[model samples]
Target chain A: MTVSIIRFGGSNCDRDAERALEHLGIDAEIVWHEDGLPEETSGIVLPGGFSYGDYLRAGAMAARSPIMADVREAAAAGTPVLGVCNGAQIGCESGLTEGAFTTNESARFQCEHVYLRVERDDTPWTAAYDEGDVIEIPIAHGEGRYEIDDERLAELEDEDRVLFRYCDENGDTGPDVNPNGSKHNIAGVLGDRETVAVLMPHPERVTLPDVGPTDGQGVLRGFEAAENGA
Target chain B: MTAYTATVTVRLKHGVLDPEAETTQQALERLGFELEDLRSADRFEIDIEAESAESAHERASEMAERLLANPTIHDYDVEVDER
Candidate 1:
């Protein structure tokens, strides 16, 4: 069983995701969006980049691509699907997840390390971490802020769909700690099911020890847990 | 078949924060312009040949629904004119 990293046009992080999964001893492959999901696919990752040059909106064009319908089917069939950064935008746009990741509150691109407090530990994405565990991940995007209706946001919070939130080192959540003005500091969220999740941070960027902090390794380890049924 | 031009405009829903518009408003204020408020929207003009105005409106509305507007945050309107 291999994790299929779907590489849409302008997807630059497909290789990074592939290597990160390999480093964790999980077999993975990069699949072009047009070619369709392989028959052996056991998991999916929507890797990030400026798909369609961010025309109209970030991930707007890519999300409407025909392949996303299949991605949605796979996610519904209980396949673990994870989207990062621009992928997060696509996930929301394609209805694989809720809400939208729009322009940053500052209206500028931001690339920085931020702390994310795990909001739930039972999901496949956060299985390796405990609730409230703070992890560092680098987010690089101009449209990383999450926007949703107040009632919907509150419902997601009540439903345990929020996976991570921007927070201080001590896991205190507030506007001051929210780098991009996401509602309630939300940095990541699960779909209707915990197996499907999306986040603005790049777990692949921090998974390798040679690079720096491996706090994100746990996020990637989620693939391992899926394989083990954990 | 009648030739028609359909214009669709998409705007953020009420109460949704628009930072780009806010920044543009601030820039205009810095330039000494007095304005009560500022908002932004995307307009798309599509040309199509259909049997009737209603058909043209339907096609353009579908375009707006499928690609031009995101229902989660955007509300859009379509206007059609015969060419």
Candidate 2:
């Protein structure tokens, strides 16, 4: 099963995602947004970058592109979909996920490695990790802060849709370690289905051994799990 | 049909954190500007041919709803005038 990585104009990380997935033994193809999803698509990856120069808002323009309709349909069909970094922004903007990733609390671009505490281990994305496991991943963005209505956020928590929270190396979550001041330190979240996920941190950035850490391998392995029907 | 201009303004909700605005406010303070508070909004003007000013306003409002503004963190208003 080949994972289709949607590449919109100004998307710069599509190649990185492809290389990372290829390194992990997963077949991946970078599909230009205008070209549409390949008919053989088995999975979807919305890789990161400043789409449309981040005009109007980060991911806003790309989210409205015609290709997204197919992506939404694929997700609804239970196809595994992962959105990373700017992809996470597009996911939220397109209503594929809850909440919006707004301007960082710091009001500037932040590029660094941060710790993420796995909120659960049952979903495909976290199957390789244990609950509360701390993984180091790099985040690069100017607008990655997550925002949602207070009551809706409470409901999201109640539904246990949170996938990961920014935390310390010891797996402790708090505002101190919330790099972007996302609500409740949420670094990632599952869409309506656990099969669909989005996060600001670049798991692919950590998947390769040459990159220093394999902590993100577990996350990318979600595609492998889907391909193998695990 | 009459030509009209629709002005749309989008701003963050009252309670949501606006880091850019906050930073700008800080910068102004550092520059010795006197201001109790500062807020920022994005404004867009669209020229269109519509049946009436009301129709232009309606179309602009719809644009705001669908693309110009996000409901989660922003509030927007649309105004139209005949050109």
The CAPRI class of candidate 2 is high
lDDT score, candidate 2, position B39: 93
lDDT of every model, 2 decimals: 0.92, 0.94
Clashes of each: 0, 0
The 10 consecutive residues of candidate 1 chain A with the worst lDDT sum are A221-230
Question: TM-score of every model?
Answer: 0.98, 0.98
lDDT of 1 at B47: 92
Model 2: per-residue Cα lDDT over A162-196, one tens digit each: 99999999999999999998999999999998899
How far residue A32's Cα lies from its native spot in candidate 2, in Å, is 0.7
Model 1: how far residue A114 lies from native, Å: 0.3
Worst 10 residues of 2 chain A by lDDT: A221-230
lDDT tens digits, residues A74-141, model 1?
Answer: 99988899999989999999999999999999999999999999998887788999999999999999
Residue A40 C-alpha lDDT in model 1: 93
DockQ of each: 0.82, 0.93
Winner by DockQ: 2
Q: lDDT (0-100) at residue A144 of candidate 1?
A: 90
